[model samples]
Target: MFKHLKSDLPASVVVFFIALPLCLGIALASGAPLFSGLIAGIVGGIVVGALSGSHIGVSGPAAGLAAIVLVAIGTLGSWENFLLAVVLGGVIQLVFGFLKAGIIGYYFPSSVIKGMLTGIGIIIILKQIPHFFGYDADPEGDFAFFQVDGENTFSEILQTFNNISPGATLIALIGLGILILWSSVLSKKGKFFQLVQGPLVAVVIGIIFYNLTKGSDLWGISTDHLVSVPVPEDASSFLAQFSFPNFGAIGNPQIWVTAFTIALVASLETLLCVEATDKLDPHKRVTPTNRELLAQGTGNIISGLIGGLPITQVIVRSSANIQSGGRTKLSAIIHGFFLLISVILIPRLLNMIPLSVLAAVLFIVGYKLAKPALFKTMYDLGWKQFVPFIVTVLGIIFTDLLVGIALGLLVGIVVILIKSYQNSHFLHIEDKSNGKHKIKMTLAEEVTFFNKGAILKELDSLPRDTYLELDVRKTRYLDNDIIEILDDFAFKAQERNIDIHLISERGMVENPPSFIEFFKLRPKSA
Candidate 1:
């Protein structure tokens, strides 16, 4: 992992700059103390990163769970009770890992996964637009269509148009301009430019811009428009920020229910991110899904023991790590350390950086994930693939991440069943011999109950006095329902004066007594 220190260090810096605001923002969105988000970020980075099999996946408090966390906190009656539920949730996830439930991730179609990445990309772009224009009414990490600020995604964008701050807009444009130049031109010029990423430069300039214009009424950026990290007055106050879970809540049935909810949702989100991150990996390394669940479970437990929110593998940071040239888990670990250190040592300095600069960085990340070329590429793949992909994208834009994926998966299953119904077998007509019609029917590789209708229809439509050649040379597994259909067809064939030839790996049989007996006599096909 250390072999790529030069690359990992710079990537970690980029992740750190991105994660800081997100940690605070997600905590704010969850209705939890801001410091709790940082705690989860630290634990997710160092603890989960160390245990995870993934090379580029980064874990943290997720925006997807903000609504759940907010409601659970109120429903459970106290923040301490909610923390207890988080710890219990982690235990449940560990159980799920031990039970080998990670295979659930493999069932998702590739079309849906690609759609998820694209949908998230569009969401990031939409959510950050207001921030890009100096509108700070909503938290930076809120990804839901309906926000906690009493406005939906589109309403917030419209609100930004009416409330743009001149200073924030000016610096945001400068930050975006610097990012484009550095990524497209300067980074290609030399190794030094590559070592120092564009986001770092943009953030530094944003801080300088904030300090330089502190006194100018028209150009000065307000506190509301900047990154907000809780500044501790002293060591005691900082330590006081950490809250312990109430063990007494363990007896409440509601706590158990909340625990199961978090476990299921967090595990699913982590599994999805693991799959998506593996696809984005340049080296194409596959992560062990069960091991990822174990790591996430452990992270959530530690986070809950402290005052942090629930933890999961997050796509935003994971994709940022991949795009910024992260080569190993060290980048994630180091980013966690950065979160731990900055909040302790230089939080006041961190609070000075403008939110618009981070928004500019996110704009680039969003563009990379949802490039215009991807839409045409999905469309070219045909309706079977494109329908699910397009549906997932629309669902995510109008609803939430999980709901969108669910909608896509449902559509994909319907497409599969339709294809199966039409592709059960192939029919070929042979030239007439002695005034008798001859037809050959070849079975598909695997004939299941789904293909029963197509196979039965073909048999029922056959004419009398015909010679039928039933070939099963390539069939591996034949369903019992199909065999019963063939048995009924055999009786009908005899009454209609049709002669049947059954072809198989074990050789041919002429007019077998029973279709079931014939298959039982032959060995199973490979």
Candidate 2:
């Protein structure tokens, strides 16, 4: 894992810069203590990162769960009570992992997964536009179109027009320009530029800009537009940041219900992200899904114990790691340390970096995710693939991440059912010189319950006294439903005077047994 530290270190720095605002923003959205998000980020990076099987996936607090967290905290009546639920949720996720529920991730079609990534990309662009232009109307990292703060995403952009801070706008534009230059040209110039990324340089420039424009005219930006990490005046106050879960709340039924809810949602979100991250991995490494669930569960447990928000594998952070050249889990571990050190020793220094600079970095990240070329590619794949992908993209953009995926999955399932209905089996008829219709029915490689209707229709349509050949020579898996259909047809074949020829790897059988009995006795077709 440490074999690629040279690449991982710099990538970790980039992910660290990306994660900071998101950690704070998600916490702010969750209605939990600001420090809780940081705690989750720390645990997600250090603890989960160590346990995860995915080399590039980064875990943290997700905006997708903010509404749930907000409601759970309010319903539980105290933040401590919610923390109790979080711990319980971790236990449930652990159970899910052990049960191998991670297989659910594989059920989603590729179209939906691609749609999710593209949708998130579009969201990042739309959501960050205001931030990039110096409008901090919504808290950082709140990408949902409809926010808990009673504001919509596009409206905030309209609002930005009325509240533009010239300092932030100038810094953001400069930051984006620096990022483009570094990534497109400067980074190729030397190893030094490659080692020290554009984001680090952009951050430095932001801090310098913050200080230089301290007393400027209209160009001056306010403290509200800055990245805010909680600062402690003394060491004791710094140590006092951690909070413990109220274990007594475990007795409440509501706590358990909330716990189960978090587990279900967090697990699903984590699984979806794992699939998406694996797709993004340039090396095409497959992450062990069950192990990833276990890792996330363990991280959430650690996070809740220390008063942090529940954790999941976040795609935004994971994609940032991949795009920034992360090669191992070390980058995630290092980023956690960065969060720890920044909050502990240099929080005030962290606060000096403007939100716009972070927005600029995310803008680039978002652009990579939802490149215009991807839209064209998806569209070119035809309606069968394109519809679900587009719907998932739209759903994610209009709703939250989970809802969008669900929508996409729904469409994908419908497409599958349609295809199944149309592709169960193939039939051909030839006129024989002996004055008979030579009918042959060929089964699909795998004929499931969904194919039962189609198979039955072909069997019933055979003319009386026809020479019928039922071929299972190429089938590998025949569902019980299809077997039952064959058995019933076989039982009534004598009444129709239709001679049936059953052929398989076992050769021709003059008298076919019951479909179930025949299948049990003979080897399946290859």
Candidate 3:
């Protein structure tokens, strides 16, 4: 891990800047105390990162869990009760790791995974628009079809536009300008500019702008436009902000439901992030998925015990970690440590940074994830890939993350089944010298129940009095259901005077007793 100290240190700075607002935002979205998000972010970075095998993956409070957390808090009647559920969820994730369930990540298609990443990119851009314009109704810019405030995502955007804050808008514009200049111009000019992250520059500029406009009545920048950084007067006061769990609520069945909800959603998100981070790693390092699951589980457990939101390997944070040039897990660990130290030692300093500045940072992030080039590349991959990719993007845009993925997966499975059906049967016919048609049928590599219809159709199409050869040499698996179909076809072939020859790994059998009985025959004792 220390091999890339120079690279990792600089990367940690960029990741730290990227993580700061997301930590606060996700907590706010979860309907938990803002500090809880910070706690989770710290644990995700330090605890999970230290234990994880992933070189560049980062973890934190995910936006995907925001809705679940909000509902859990309400159903459990308190944020503390929700923490208990989060801890339980962590235990469940550890069980998933022990069971070796992390292999499930390998089954997801590449197209679906790409779709998920692209969908999330689009959602981030959409969700941040209101915050960019100074709308703070929902703290972290949660992008649900229906918000906790009883408004849809689009409705909230409209409402924000109608009630736009001028000072916030101006600050946002300036911050965006600074970020763009830093990325597009200064970043390429010199190594110094590249080393200095764009978000940090935007944030510093935002603070200066805020101070410059703080006392001027002519500027029209109101207090509403300023960053609402929570400030506690002293150490005792700050400690008072921490909330403990309501262990008494453990008896409630609703608590279990919330626990399962967190476990499942957090686990899925973590797995997806692990897969995505591996794809993005410049070194192509493969993360140990089970180990990652255990690490995430432990982090969630610790976070919940401390009144923090549940943690996951969030794609947004992981992507940020990679794009920032993180070369080792140390970057992630250090970033979390920074979160822990910042809230404890420099809360006031953090409060000085404007939301517009953070928005500018996220704007760049969103662009990197959902650039036009990504869309074009997916499109060029053909409809099989593009269809699911587009559906996922649209679904996530109109619905939510999980729903979009489900839709994409559904489309992806359909494509697979269609391809399977098309390739299930191969037929060849030639005229034999003995006044019989010589026929050959080659079954697919794997004949499952799904291939039954095609196999049956092919068998039924054979002409009477034809000599048939069935080849299963290349087939590795034959489902019982498909074997039954072949069994039935054998009797029909006899009736049509179609002499059958079976070729399999077991050996060639001419005039077999029955298809089912033939397949059941094992090698003789030898």
Q: Which should have the higher lDDT, number 1 or number 3? A: 1
Q: After superposition, how far is residue 22 of candidate 1 from its true place, in Å?
A: 1.3
For every candidate in turn, the CA RMSD to the true structure comes to 1.8, 2.7, 2.8
lDDT of 2 by residue, 402-431 (tens): 999999999999899889978888888888
Please give the CA lDDT of all the candidate structures. Answer: 0.93, 0.90, 0.81
lDDT of 3 at 373: 93
Off by over 4 Å in 3: 215-221, 248-252, 431-437, 494-497, 505-513, 522-526
Alpha-carbon error at 226 in model 1, in Å?
Answer: 1.0
> What is the C-alpha local distance difference test score of candidate 2?
0.90
Candidate 3 lDDT for residue 9:
73
- TM-scores for every candidate against the unseen true structure: 0.96, 0.91, 0.91
Model 2, position 434: C-alpha lDDT score: 69
Q: What total of clashing residue pairs does each candidate reach? A: 0, 0, 0
